[model samples]
Target: MQEITTIGLDIAKSVFQVHGIDAFGAVIVRRQLRRSQVLPFFRKLSGCVIGIEACATAHHWARELEKVGHEVRLMPPRYVKPYVKRNKNDAADAEAICEAVQRPTMRFVPIKSPEQQSVLMLHRTRQLFIRQRTALINAIRAHLAEFGIVAGIGRHGVEKLLDLITRGEDERIPPAAHACLMALAAQLAMVKRQILEADRRLLAWRRTSKTSKRLEAIPGVGPLIATALVASIPDPNVFRSGRDLSAWIGLVPKQSSTGGKERLGSITKAGNRYLRSLLVVGALSVIRRAKQLGYTRHPWLVRLMERRSVKIAAIALANKIARIAWAMMAHNESYRTPLPASA
Candidate 1:
């Protein structure tokens, strides 16, 4: 081996591909490694730069590679795509990853710690359960509507339907249909319990994390949003500014500039979808509260709401909130309430 200086690894469930080059850009190694052989193979090589595409199991592999004295850089798969010469294959993808890591301008994803990954996993699982709950609720509603038994929308309405199913007193419901609705009702109850448990775990995590606790002080930020934000962003300083963080969360407008003419459309919605949606939902809550009070602490939001529709204002508020969060995290400071317009 001619002193392999850089390596690109394409990882999968069972097999992995490796491509390596010397300092002089000459091929040093091109091979495949089984799942069992990956760590042992890297252990034999001297410390060198290794590139891997950010994907499933990428973080685990990166953590493993780093433990064996190798420098690992994780590149977004999209950024590596341009470097691929021809047909897509594990080998080509590995080569592209190898090439992309050496680029001075290429952006790399920050390696998340196991703790962060765990928190994100909790969030994902909770989201899954919530979706299941919604599906169950909708199914029950549709089934009941078939029997001319309909309830209003919301938790109370869902509970009413559940009550009907539990009592088995709705004469309109067919016996067979009643049995099916009972099954769904049981699932809905289980899912609700699971959601509450998830919320409890998240709350416990938020209590232990000083960052999450501090983040909760910000308007519209609850324990769930605070914990998710902290876990999703491993290092706030990776972003150059609050705007960058907001943009990364896909809260900023999409641009289609040409010939020095600036044209912007809807938000790019390119980055972490979960975080973006959370921020937007939080913003909407703030807007709703402000409307109820007929005044807001932040005059800028009040002015913006006066000029734009509620939805647009919510987006702008979400963008601002993201920026505020970035600043707080990067600087290790609490959120400062903006002065009232009168002041």
Candidate 2:
């Protein structure tokens, strides 16, 4: 029933802390609420600005709070970290979030929509399953190698191994080991099927999503790049330019500055790991095909390949592709490839 000027919320799985202050910067309210009671408490409060760290589940909370007529700002966790006092606790974090949100220089995270999260989740689940399947395949291959059977070390190799195991070609194999191998092979097949299904869902979602469709129009951006870009970036404005987007995705080089001197290193390797990886893979494929299909005769590819190894060229190209993808998203235009100069 009180007029709260600003509120800092420290959200957790079960309990939450609400730190409230008034116009003159006086602490007016400090209360702890259970998960079930948190929303009702906010609904009853006078509409005010709510500050929360841009953490897990923050967007969902941000949208929920907005519906109650309160403005929500989600601060990046790194920015909020410097504000925490010596004694770090819920209340301290809540208070720190309170101070961080009011700064004009602070960059707040753009709240992701539920649909965005859903599409991203498919990618994440597929990544997890792929990792598991890879580990299992390696183990199966290693175990079989002890008995003079070897998997040649590729997806196709794993597939063939599974076929050999399923057909029971090795009757001399121990029953227990055969059982384990068969089980692993079956699970690996399941995971492959799931990954394919996820790809199907992503492709379907891309068909209906304008942003993904536009991104996919770019030369190298297939389902992976299209989905990764849309899912990872919640706001295009957060990046001042496409270069900034690429840099944020760790495509840009790291730098160190001293007195009148500057040195640059390899890519910073910060930000969304999955998106960076997808971009790298897409770019590598493009580079490989360009070499094999004689597209290397193209000026850019020729000059790039001449300057560095194919692997390095692929990474640089990937970096440029990421920037271009951002530009496409920000400008709401289809990709415009560069044309050769007039004769």
Candidate 3:
């Protein structure tokens, strides 16, 4: 009807809402489609601009829509919120998405390919198993503490506790209590094994990814961080500059400025928590090495560490690393550390 020029779609597990407007921005269609009807519905319409929130299933649908000759744009859910007129509903959200996609300055998310999503799946699964392993270890520790069978910190310590429990050396641990701990210990071992398998798979993936291999050349970057960045950010050129990329990664400071006064606080910590944490962890490794070498190799980091706390310096370094990574990806170059000029 009225040759719909643009459409906004609100996607859910079983149903989807659609809002459409003509070239003149007049409302033309409002409808809902069941999951099974989605492709058939879109197949009936001519190619048009479509907007969707960048949520769980958005990328898959975007790819499908694109293949059908429709232009799809995905915006972050928060960016679409401001366009909502009143109470939130599926229809309202669709309308907001429709409006948001037309804004010239509205940011959009890159649609990742199935291959990119697969690599990310590996990382996510690995993270889940690691978390489960940690929880099991903590549970074991807590249970042992009740019987005064405490061990020192870290995973090795947990293994020691498990050894004692398995040997039945302590009368303090009743047979019944020990059995429960043994079950937990078994789970911990299984989770650890799963995590290791994930790691092996990631490493195999990294070996085949030229971009991941290039990213690994940077200081403090290893297979894990390299593969993660390559998977999560399909296109680094979407950002205008390295600083923009760092900001997108939420490595930049939060600003609260008014009346032409500049006020900056801690980092916003707004985007991609997993990537941000990986960058920070990489930065920490660099910092640790720099400290051991008496900061001889990294002059800038030496100056930064002298003026700021280790935590702040680590964040700053992470921001710098993210920027460097963006440049590498944008320019298709491997990382190369700069050398100080001759006196």
Candidate 4:
């Protein structure tokens, strides 16, 4: 039997498919296993390099495999796509993973620890509740609008609308309609409470994490952004430089340069949308303050504002903030704004 040197695992909820190859790249093991049998099968094999797509259960399996002395490498699913020979099925994906994992230039995702994943879960849960709250608010507003009842815009306005729904004083709203709106209103209240609790938990995390605290010292970063970045980015050193980190966040401009002429356009917007949005919001906050104060305090920002529109300047500042944040994490240093040189 050819010694199985590499195994590509395509993981699913109930079953898993595996394609194993020998040192000379010959197919040695092509098999499927139930979820319950996966660990036992791998335990029988000698320690070998395992490759899996970086999705759903990949991190958990990576940790499990590494415990038994196997070298596990996870590749982004997109990077493995080109390796598929014919069809896109479990076997083909497993084969692609096997091939991609061995490529010298293939990038691997950092295996996140349980703690890091837990923190990310908190962020995700909070975001979910917040979104639910927004949808509920919009529903309530739309329903009220049908009866010529309209509240002002914003959370305070939502409160006014809720009060009207709760009081049941408006004769225009039929009893059946009132009951339905009240139910939605009740749900909205519950979601709001959940969101507030989530915020408290995130704040607690922000207070305890030293790196998160350091991130908060940056101009645009608040507790939310600070804690979020700490949770999302498991290893800053994965990137070779701060610019790479910024690019990874998709804060850099999209470029189409050919034949020595450079063409640049809007941001790539390729990476974590949540993180990018938070950073852009933070940048907008900074820009608002800078605009009000005439940018005297941030001379560099002033010069940037002169060259570009306020929105573009804000994005550029956000890119800088991302780079600065990467530097802070990479160096284990706190953020300290560089002072303008004296004339």
The alpha-carbon lDDT assigned to residue 151 of candidate 1 equals 97
Q: What tens-digit string does per-residue lDDT give for candidate 1 at 1-343?
A: 5898999999999999999999999988999999999999999999999999889999999999999999999887888999999998999999999899999998888899999999999999999999999899999999889889999999999888899899998789989998898899888889999999999898888888999988888988998899999999989988999999998889999999999999999998988999999999999999899888876576788888778899999899899889999999999999788776565
Q: Which stretches of candidate 2 lie over 4 Å from their true place?
A: 295-298, 341-343
What are the lDDT figures for the candidates, one per model?
A: 0.92, 0.85, 0.92, 0.90
| Root-mean-square deviation of every model | 1.2, 2.0, 1.1, 1.5
How many clashing pairs in candidate 1? 0
Angstrom error of the Cα, residue 202, model 3: value is 0.3
lDDT of 2 by residue, 182-286 (tens): 888888778889889988888888888788888887767897779878887877978899888877788888999899898988889887788889888888888
Model 4 misplacement above 4 A? none
User: Which pairs of residues collide in candidate 2?
Assistant: none
Off by over 4 Å in 3: 341-343
Which pairs of residues clash in candidate 1, taking residues 3 or more apart in a chain or in different chains?
none
Scored against the true structure, residue 31 in model 3 reaches a CA lDDT of 92
Output the TM-score of candidate 1.
Answer: 0.97
Cα shift from native, residue 19, model 1 (Å):
0.5
Q: Of 2 and 3, which scores higher on TM-score? A: 3
* TM-score for candidate 4: 0.96
Candidate 4: residue 248 lDDT (0-100): 76
Q: How accurate is candidate 3 locally (lDDT)?
A: 0.92
For model 2, the run of ten residues with the poorest summed lDDT: 294-303
